[model samples]
Target: MHATEALRRLLEHCPELDRTHDLVRQFASMLDARDAAPLPDWLDHLAVSRLPALDGLAKAIREDQHAVVQGITTPFNSGVNEGRITDLKLQKRIMAGRAGVPLLRHRVILMAGLRRSYP
Candidate 1:
């Protein structure tokens, strides 16, 4: 495809982009595999890659290194809780100026019960 050819030419012209792309792929694979073993080495490489954006990400991850490692190694996650919060926010927006807090609370509780029933 045209996009593929363009990307190939771009990577050929910019070796740094090629390196960054490989690093990004590696990081994605780590997340998919739920493995943190390579994280520290990856962070070190990213920091010295001279790429400002990736360097900033490395710095932020280093700050929360423990949480990151735990998240990677554990099966438990905040996904369900986050989904409920998102649903609550959307419901709030939809009902804004149209209903009272009592109505909103009732609807959220109903929805939560429905989710439990189906899931």
Candidate 2:
């Protein structure tokens, strides 16, 4: 009936798949928790699980261990700055043929709500 039920039916006869599913859930919960404390144990499990697909991921996690921890521990990110830059680029592209630098500057200023109203 549902996707979850279908998946359960599919994995019902496969012990290996059930084990894989458990490992996947554990990793997912660890990621959601954003605490690297379980990472070491997770990595060990990954190695022991003998899943070739996760080998590259394990290596990547090991290589970027510090950055990953910082990402999980800190609430800081460049998302806002990146979004602003993306908006500017899109605006520039949309106004490319219809206008020049001066109009583009005015549009950007207006879009940013920086244009002053006439008194």
TM-score of each: 0.62, 0.56
Query: Which parts of model 1 have CA positions greater than 4 angstroms off?
Result: 2-6, 83-119
What C-alpha lDDT do the candidate models reach, one value each?
A: 0.91, 0.77
Clashes of each: 0, 0
Q: lDDT for model 1, please.
A: 0.91
Cα lDDT tens digits, model 1, 1-119, are 69999999999999899989899898888889999999999999999999999899999999999999998888899989998898788888888758788998888898899889998
Clashing residue pairs, backbone N/CA/C < 3 A, model 1: none
